[model samples]
Target: MTQGSARTDLRIGQLNVAEGPAFEEFYEIFCEALPASERKPRELIVALATRSDYYLLIGEIGGRVMSFAILYLSDRYPIALLEYLGTSAAARGKGLGAEMFRAAIDRIGSDSLVIEVDSDRQDSGDLEMRRRRKQFYARLGARQIPGVEYRMPKIGADSPPELDLMVRPGGGRTHVTKDEMAAWIEDIFRGAYHRAVPREELARMIQAMPSHVDLIP
Candidate 1:
């Protein structure tokens, strides 16, 4: 297991097997950090566990949730897409979140990282915090890809909703030609976005691509 030095006063350990009733202890951390959530930590963890491709890890201090991140792998894109991420309200300024992230990077080992931030953050103050997340990825030399749409039908998305794509390239796949890129995007959009994309729109978007543009899928 990878370990990073953290504040001595803080317990700074990883969360393990928190899907059961044991999560009650960590409930306050979620309630305090994410008021928008309807249930406690354990309840959410149980629901999240049922989803395929999702992974969860956390940081705790004195039995409180100090930091946590959720990752879900795409069917076609090997990228690990970070979903829910939060640091305790009390532990915001500490290196707890960074430590958790570093541990994730170590576990994934040079695999690409991808995540979406609500473009508007209109629902919560997390938008600003999400910017910090972007900075975090940048600090690790992750590349952010703009102008990409994130449509997830598995999440019951109905439109070709657009979100910026942040990518940490690790596999060294060469950039692909425009046509190839379009095909690649189509495949992932189908897999990742599912029914959210209308078939006609998918074809139109891929077919209209300029020949010279290239992107790595």
Candidate 2:
């Protein structure tokens, strides 16, 4: 279907366990789109699905699923981590990804949303792809968390994984101080990543961020 028609016929909602076909499609497509090192095991996906904080949303057009988004919402705060978002290759470049994102941000009221992007690394040759990915989010009004050296925990044996934390204002203006950044880091580590960030590492990460900074746009 065309982009305009897809938007007109679009339907977005949580991907519950009962939606077997949709969920399977999402998983299969996600596996194809993401690298093995970056992808999570199917069991983990199932486990996270049972939790209230984790959300898996499926976007469908005329009853056929086309995209998926995985979000982790903080129970104590109005913040969310956009874990993964993907559209089937056949349906890409037709605004499905952006449409699903807009719906998600609107649904969550975008108080504070965090997403990770690959950092520029000399050895990693996908620098341009990473930059374009950042630019895509920038177009969506998300900005990099300035002055922070964020290191994503190694997932699937990839050592020294690095990522840039990007934030965006959803409902209102935002002021991200060091303490707030710390809180975000803590929550993401424990809640989303399912691992505790070491105190020293956390301290270093927080220290890299300025004592106070505003990333709202």
Candidate 3:
């Protein structure tokens, strides 16, 4: 909360993969905290079950999953997408969110801590929360992708619509061309979408994203 001191923890990274069932259950439970429309696709679950990139980072005050985070690795950049992050309903705003984010970002130091926030060209309640969230990340020295727009389409489809692709290149500039940035997102969907976000589907969505001028660049 004060600084990027605890951006991540290797404790969960050290977790054994045999807990796939538990991981899946936790994955579902974690979904409740995310915006209903922003849930991770099913393909991501399969990838998480089959691969080890997804971190079931559990935050505990006294040995409980007060909060959890899913960190998705990237193929094109030396970064980890902050993917799905949330605290338990009973645990919001108690510094648990900050600590969880810090612990994760700390491990993947210097690389971007990218996240897609809902876009708002018009200020509203959502925009206010976005402002607050941005402030939180700013405290950790992360940068938002300037001129960039983030979006996620409807489930089982590729051409729903665009939302907001907010980015935070941690403590530095993480430059990428439009083609490169779009591919970066496609990489995310293909690797860890909740359902089977096929390569083609991911490609379609990525192709639809708008270009931007990144601050870190």
Top candidate, metric TM-score: 2
Which model is ahead, 2 or 3, in terms of TM-score? 2
Off by over 4 Å in 3: 1-29, 41-49, 123-125, 156-162, 170-174, 194-217
Clashes of each: 1, 1, 27
Cα displacement (Å) at residue 100, model 2: 1.6
TM-score of each: 0.63, 0.89, 0.68
Q: Give the TM-score of candidate 3.
A: 0.68
* RMSD of model 1 against the true structure: 5.5
List runs of model 2 lying over 4 Å from the truth: 1-6, 121-123
lDDT per residue (tens digit) for residues 83-125 in model 3: 7667777767777777777777766777676775555555666
- Greater-lDDT candidate between 2 and 3: 2
Q: For residues 120-145, could you state the per-residue lDDT of candidate 2 as single tens digits?
A: 64457788888888888889888888
lDDT by residue (99-150, candidate 1, tens digit) is: 7666566656655666554443235556775577678767765555443444
RMSD per candidate (Å) reads 5.5, 3.0, 5.6
